[model samples]
Target: MIVTVQPTGISAADVLAVARGDARVELSPATVEAMAASRAIVDDIESSGRPVYGVSTGFGALANTSIAPQRRAELQHALIRSHAAGIGAPMPREVVRAMMLLRVRSLAMGRSGVRPVLAQGLVDLLNHEITPWVPEHGSLGASGDLAPLAHCAIVLLGEGWVLGKDGARMSAAEALHGAGLRPLDLAAKEGLALINGTDGMLGMLLLAIEDAAHLFAMADVTAALAIEAMLGSERPFLPELHSIRPHPGQAASAANIHRLLQDSAIMDSHRDDLAHAVQDAYSMRCAPQVAGAARDTLEFVSLVSSRELVSVVDNPVVLTDGRVESTGNFHGAPLGFAADYLAIAAAEVGAIAERRVDRLLDVTRSRNLPPFLSPDAGVNSGLMIAQYTAAGIVAENRRLASPASVDSLPTSGMQEDHVSMGWAATKKLRTVLDNLTSLLAVELLAGVRGLQLRSPLAPSPAGRAAVAAVEPFAGTPGPDLFLAPVLEQARAVVAGRALRGEIEAAVGPLS
Candidate 1:
């Protein structure tokens, strides 16, 4: 089914469906008429023969340069050609698709003065699974992700390369012909309209936000399994304990942990402090505080994305009264700051999770599980290197979590100085989220194996179910085996692609 584009609204889920999932998108009837209305205004400006910023005059430092009506069409092509200067490896295909989807959504708002065919061309490219060969670099993330979006725009004109489904690069013209569509002859201001929004950074943020939401839930699940496996008390996660501080995310995480560990004989076995340490390490003791902080950050970022989804982020937006006025709505400062904050939170989540995995490996720290959770510590190395791998990823997250938004370089001959670098923020945020899921999965795998080692002491029903949910991916636990594959299996579970539904089946909706 198609996701109908509306003027005032679009949701993150809707973007994900069209961008990542195989959902087609099109302009609603009202949006089609709206585009016609906005396009007519641009035609009037063109016939008047006066220079408008992006409509007839040059861009950025060259804004004072004027073009005659005969050369106006050439001006649009030149704008796209010069700005399609991105260099680096190609960005992930999913992000490119999302960027395309969002660009069309922005156009569908009818403020950019683009014709319907321009929007339809983007939809056609997406529907045909033809992704523009968008480079990973470029985009100071202000002036609307110019470099990256230009790569996308170039494909619309049949002038650049595109990625086919078979992972081969083909000419944009070939891709368009195969998809039964034609290249756009960009109308006035349409070139600036294509590359002049926050879509590139905004698209990455939407997917990262979605990924973060799932992994944050997995954090609670893994933290619960870690708590029971380590013989930690649930008193710290008590609803009454959280009510005093009253951070909604904290309360929610604590409640989930407490509920998942319910009816556990392992927890019951240590109810009176019969054998285990009186307290857990900070990684175990402070699960909710760290994870909950990340959860709250996720919520904040989502709110920002939700606002951006419905916004008219174009520069020189066309008002209802036919006034085209330059505006700074194209600035990416909001998204830059939000993505940076979430990256910090995500890195911490990984850091703490890695500590827990290390603790589970250390016999002295594991509260009497075998060394590295291996029964034969000398003969079998167990997950010692697996913990190392998680630690390495955690360290990388630390490196990546440094705020990209804080760093700016002057561009457009200093006419556009002090960029948000939001594209950089969202790019690294994706990496941090990836590392976070792996870190949590390492902890979950070790925690579950440790739980199995405590044979006579049964886990809570939900805990057992979590273990069962990952059982296929995690494989039958034994002495040392190929640990990388085992962790990869568990990572899928923690990433919520595999076990979330089954675990939620046994427990309930998480977060």
Candidate 2:
């Protein structure tokens, strides 16, 4: 698929296709016209010898200093090299691609006063599958992920490392030459244009939102199966029950659990019995409430992402009326707050899932299921350590959930005081989601075994499908043997969303 860059902007879906799906990119003629118009304004300003913030002067604390026209090209090159000082492991390929694509989107808007060739060069990089080596650190999320983006921008100058078409790490010079691409001599404000935006944090935010959608939907499915494994009541998920509350997420979750529990043999067996408790534990009964809140939080985050998608996030943006003015549109506080909020939501979802895993292992709370779901209580450890792993992750999530946006630190010689720490927030959000995936996998392992221990009573059709999907990877309930590999395999299944896919196949798509 080819995503055309236009001055009107692109959507989050378009970014996802380019970033993860390796979609080719092209500059619309309209974008070229916009860039040419903006470039004309910049060229006039340059020839007039008027001092603009980025076009004719130094940056940050050095903004007051002016440079002669002869050294302006060198200024742009020096800016990219100095800011490319990020030191850490390289960021993922998808993130770099997304960042590069977003930079193109910003420049295509003709707001940063760059020529059409610059945007076309970035598009060429994407089409050829050449990914720059960008480190994980060095972005304060103010001045819009400067250092990390500089690493990417430096590749355009043919002076950095890149993952080539074959995914091998090679010199940017070699990669560009081999691909029949020429190195760029960055003109006035071009380096600042390339590096100034919230693309890194925003890219992470978009990717996290996509993952959370699947994880949150599957969370409901896993909770439904856990409820069945514990023989919990489905009455709480009734539509009438959620109708009064009217939170869309809650209603959707309740509806999913209710649908999954339909015609459940175990539920039918307990429907008329007084022995089953009048109410289940909060973890089981309030599953929708917790997961639904996370759903709503993600909706808000998605809203923020949508706004950012159309934004021209550069330091000195060119206006339609031919004025290039410095602005703080590059600040990342919006994305930072959204990422922190999402981390909290993800952490809570994992916490509740962990609670359910604990309930399945506890003999007292798990109804009459064998201790730790073990066939022989004393002989085999069965899933006991899995609960421990889940608990540890939940604890770590609690720590990670401490909002990164709140701990603002000043940098750039105090010129950039009170930065948005949005990059840190997005990075932690990824970890929280990863841990959530693993935590839910542990729940799936125990929940499926608990349901299987019920024998002829039979789980709901969705539950049976979930069992079949997971059993191949995690193996059937029996004496514990080589449990770490089982947990890892189950993690892969959950991460791949195979369990959710099977459940959806059996009971239609979940919300």
Candidate 3:
């Protein structure tokens, strides 16, 4: 399918499509008109021989320095070459693609005064899969991801390197030549326009935020399964209980939990026969509060991401009235704070999930199930070690949860006196997500085991569908077996493969 860029909006799903190499870009007519208008203003500025920041003068600490018109092309080329200093491992292909798409979107907004041909070059690169080999590190996420973006921009001039389809690194010239493409020329602010934006950091954060949202939902579903497996009360999720102090996320989470457990014969049979009449432990009972808080965090992150995606986060924006205005929209503090918050919320999910895994493995807390849910206690360690792994991840998540946005270091001779460090936070959030996925998987495995012990009484339709999805991949617990594959399958289920159809079928349709 062809994905068009509209000034009205962009979606996370569209970004994913571009990353996956399905690129058919259509620029909005309004955006094209805006680009043409901005270019005219830039031409007038050049004709009048007036100096502009990053256009006729040097950048950042060297902004006071002037470049003569005779050396303008050399100046722009040198700006790209000298600033392409990103170091560390190459970023994933998807991140590179996202960076390209975001830059294209920003340029298409027509506030950066880039030429149409230069903007189209980015689209052409996306279409032909000629992705630049951008590195993971080097952006302080201030000054608009200058260094990392320079790496991306250099490819347009056929100066840097690009990754080939066969996983080989080739010079941009070779890649373009092999694909029947020609190198581009930077006219006026084209180089600065390409390299002066928050696209790099924003792209990474967008993907991270999207993943965090999915995991947030999965965290709630997994916690619900654990609640039933431990024979915990559903009273905590009652609408009446949450309505008095209604946080929308909390209320919505309660509703979702009630829906997930609606048809559980295990819950019904246990509620009637179990000796305890009051409520379950906080880990099982307050699952909504913990998971709902994460969902709320995602809600705020989504708002921030949506705004950043549409914003013209570049310096020296060209006004519609043909005026050039220098600004600091490039500052990444907003995104940095959002990424840190996301990490903290994701860590909480892991924290509570670890506790549920602990409950399932404990003899006293497991409600008459064998210790560690093992058939034979001594011969089989059962899920004992899995709980330990989950605990270890939870501890690590606590450390990773430290807010990266809270810390800052001076750079650019203190010209960039405050750094966002948001990229650092986003990177750590990805790690937190990895640990959370594994931790949730462990809890799912334990919950399924506990559910098996309660059988004869059927699980809820959602729970049964979840169990069936993993059953094909899970083996009966035995001595000293590897659990990685089982964890992977469980993760796939939580990520929308296993119970997705059943859940959607019941819920009708998802927005």
The lDDT leader among the candidates is 2
Candidate lDDT scores, in order, read: 0.86, 0.91, 0.80
Whole-model lDDT, candidate 2? 0.91
Summed backbone clashes in each candidate are: 0, 0, 0
Displacement of the residue 187 alpha carbon in candidate 1, Å: 1.6
The clash tally of candidate 2 reads 0
lDDT accuracy of residue 372 in candidate 2? 95
lDDT of 3 by residue, 154-198 (tens): 998988998877767789999889878899888777778888777
Question: Which 10-residue window of candidate 3 scores lowest in summed lDDT?
Answer: 502-511
Residue lDDT tens for model 2, 1-511: 9999999899999999999999999999999999999999999999999999888999999999998899999999999999999988888899999999998999998888899999998999999989999988899998989999999899899999997556666899998998999999999989889899999999999999999999998889889989999999999999999999999999998999999998789889888888999999999999999999999999999999999999989989988887888889899999999999999999999999999999999999999899999988788989999899999999999999999999888887899998999999999999999999999889888889998899889899888987887777667778777878888887887788666777778788899
TM-score of 3: 0.95
lDDT for 468 in candidate 1 is 82
Question: Which residue pairs does candidate 3 place in steric collision?
Answer: none
* Candidate 1 CA-lDDT value: 0.86
